[model samples]
Target: MKVVKVNLAKNVAKVDIGGTQQWIRLDIVNEVPKIGDYVIVHAGFAIYRLDEKEAQETLSLFEEMLRHEAPLH
Candidate 1:
């Protein structure tokens, strides 16, 4: 997931997950993330931050899975 925005007041961050945007709570994360940072979100919360390489790798894997599992048209 990519951090798009952060709501410090609410302790929630808006993230882009596989092109979809959603708000995730930051209470579970040890480190605060800024916009453009990649994070690992689970159960409506960010668990950890990902480096650029890891982020790209994860995104690629997701894209691959989507491409293979998408419904045939």
Candidate 2:
């Protein structure tokens, strides 16, 4: 799945995946994520949020696949 956008408010986040948006309630027991972040969404919930580097890498791979780029080591 691809994370199209992230909207964070207070402690919760609304992650938009593909063309669908899902509301993820953050646990008050943990830290809150910032806006424009990428999260690992499952079952209408965001389990974890990826860092900027990882998010960039993921999007890069998606773009590469769309362009049919060869895998690099």
Candidate 3:
């Protein structure tokens, strides 16, 4: 999902999809990602924070997917 906002003090993030908003907590076990950085979120947890290269790759993949079809889950 797309990371819309990051709350560092709470270690949580606000993600949005199709106008639906959700809060995703960051895993304390993983390195804390900075604001504006994107991570792979699952359920309520941020499983893995993406590095620069990975984030770019992921964004590209997302764009490709969006180009193919409407976002439906």
Candidate 4:
């Protein structure tokens, strides 16, 4: 999930995975993500937050990888 909406008081965040909203816990995150942050959720928890440039680059790489896989498979 990239986009995030956090309710820090409740220690939960609704993240946008594709177009759907999924809730993830912030208990294990150490430093919680802000409203506009980009994060990676693992096991229903926010584990990593990526900066804007990193998020863009990682997404670009994923898109490139998808394009490569589609033709080969």
Candidate 5:
């Protein structure tokens, strides 16, 4: 996910998740993320920042897995 904006007072950030926007807490990350940074979000929190290579790899993996999965009715 890419960070779009941050709310320091709330300790949360607004991020783009595959084009969709969502808010995630920043408390879990080791370092604060600036806008345009890529992060790994889990359970409503930004767990860690991802380097460019790792981000691409992770995104590709997710796309591949999702493509083969059965869709919900």
Candidate 6:
């Protein structure tokens, strides 16, 4: 997912999960994240930040997996 917005005062961030907008807590992450940064989220918390190249590759893999699975549903 990609961080699209950050509310430092509130320790919250809005991230883009695929095409969906999700709000996650920034307090749990080791470092603060900024907009346009990719992050790893779990249980409504941003757990880690990811580099752009890695994030895009991961997203690509997920898209490929979904494409392969789409015919089943």
RMSD of 4: 2.2
Between which residue pairs do clashes occur in model 4? none
TM-score of 3: 0.59
Lowest-lDDT window of 10 residues in candidate 1? Answer: 64-73
Each model's total of backbone clashes: 0, 0, 0, 0, 0, 0
In candidate 6, stretches whose alpha carbon ends up further than 4 angstroms from where it belongs are 70-73
Model 2, span 1-73: residue lDDT tens? 3344444544456666566776676663134556666776566566777877887788788888889876687
Identify the runs in model 4 with alpha carbons over 4 angstroms from their true place.
Answer: 70-73
Per-residue lDDT tens digits of candidate 1, residues 5-71?
A: 9999999999996589999999989699999999998899999988879899998998899888957
* lDDT pick, better of 4 and 6: 6
Worst 10 residues of 3 by lDDT: 27-36
lDDT of 5 by residue, 1-73 (tens): 9889999999999999768999999998977988988899899999999876888899999999999999798
Tell me model 3's lDDT, rounded to 2 decimals: 0.75
Q: What TM-score would candidate 4 get against the native?
A: 0.80
Which portions of model 3 miss their true places by more than 4 Å? 1-4, 16-21, 65-73
Poorest 10 consecutive residues of model 2 by lDDT? 1-10
CA lDDT, every prediction? 0.91, 0.63, 0.75, 0.80, 0.90, 0.89
Identify the superior model by lDDT, candidate 2 or candidate 3.
Answer: 3
lDDT of 4 at 39: 82
- Taking all chains together, each candidate's TM-score versus the true structure is 0.79, 0.52, 0.59, 0.80, 0.82, 0.84
Pairs in steric clash, model 2: none
Give lDDT: candidate 1, residue 11.
Answer: 96
Residue-level lDDT of model 4, residues 1-73, one tens digit each, is 6656778789899888568889898887746788877887789988888877877888889889888785544
* Model 1 C-alpha lDDT versus the unseen true structure: 0.91
Model 4, CA-based lDDT:
0.80
